[model samples]
Target: MKGKEILSAIKKDIDEHVGEKVLLKANSGRRKVMVREGILEKTYPNIFVIRVEGNDRTSRTISYSYSDILTQTVQLVFKNNNVAI
Candidate 1:
């Protein structure tokens, strides 16, 4: 799929999961892989936010743009099935 189409679909799925729990897997570098379970907080025009809880039980929000998802820097998974956008 074209980049734009893929981005749009990702946005749609994010909208559907707002306020629901999902897994976010991000790879910033070879040794910087991050996997967190969070609630899909919201979807913005150019970005989406997730509310992740830390080991200490503190919650924080992280925002990633569509470009991030499109480039595979961030991946969203629900119920073990990766949301392929």
Candidate 2:
């Protein structure tokens, strides 16, 4: 697939999983990685959001563009099935 096609495919996959539990792994630079468990929230035309809760009972939303997934800068996996999207 071409770049636009691939991005669209990624967006479609995420759209199907909205409101589901997902595990997010992201590269935070300097050899550090950030991992979080969150519910897949909303998908805009350019980005998708995830709601992550902290140990202190706090929650925040993080959004990433579809290109991040295409470039492997971000990864998403379904919590229940352990399948990467």
Q: Which model scores highest in lDDT?
A: 2
Clashes of each: 0, 0
Tell me model 1's lDDT, rounded to 2 decimals: 0.83
Best by TM-score: 2
Report lDDT per candidate: 0.83, 0.93
C-alpha RMSD between model 1 and the true structure? 2.5
User: Which 10 residues in a row give candidate 2 its minimum summed lDDT?
Assistant: 76-85
Task: Provide the lDDT at 43 for model 2.
Answer: 99
Q: lDDT by residue for model 2 over 1-85, one digit each (tens)?
A: 5888889999998898888999999999999999999999899999999999999999999999999998899999998778897
lDDT of 1 by residue, 1-85 (tens): 6877888887887787778778888987977989999988888988988999999999999999988877789888875455543
Q: Ten residues in a row with the worst lDDT in model 1?
A: 76-85
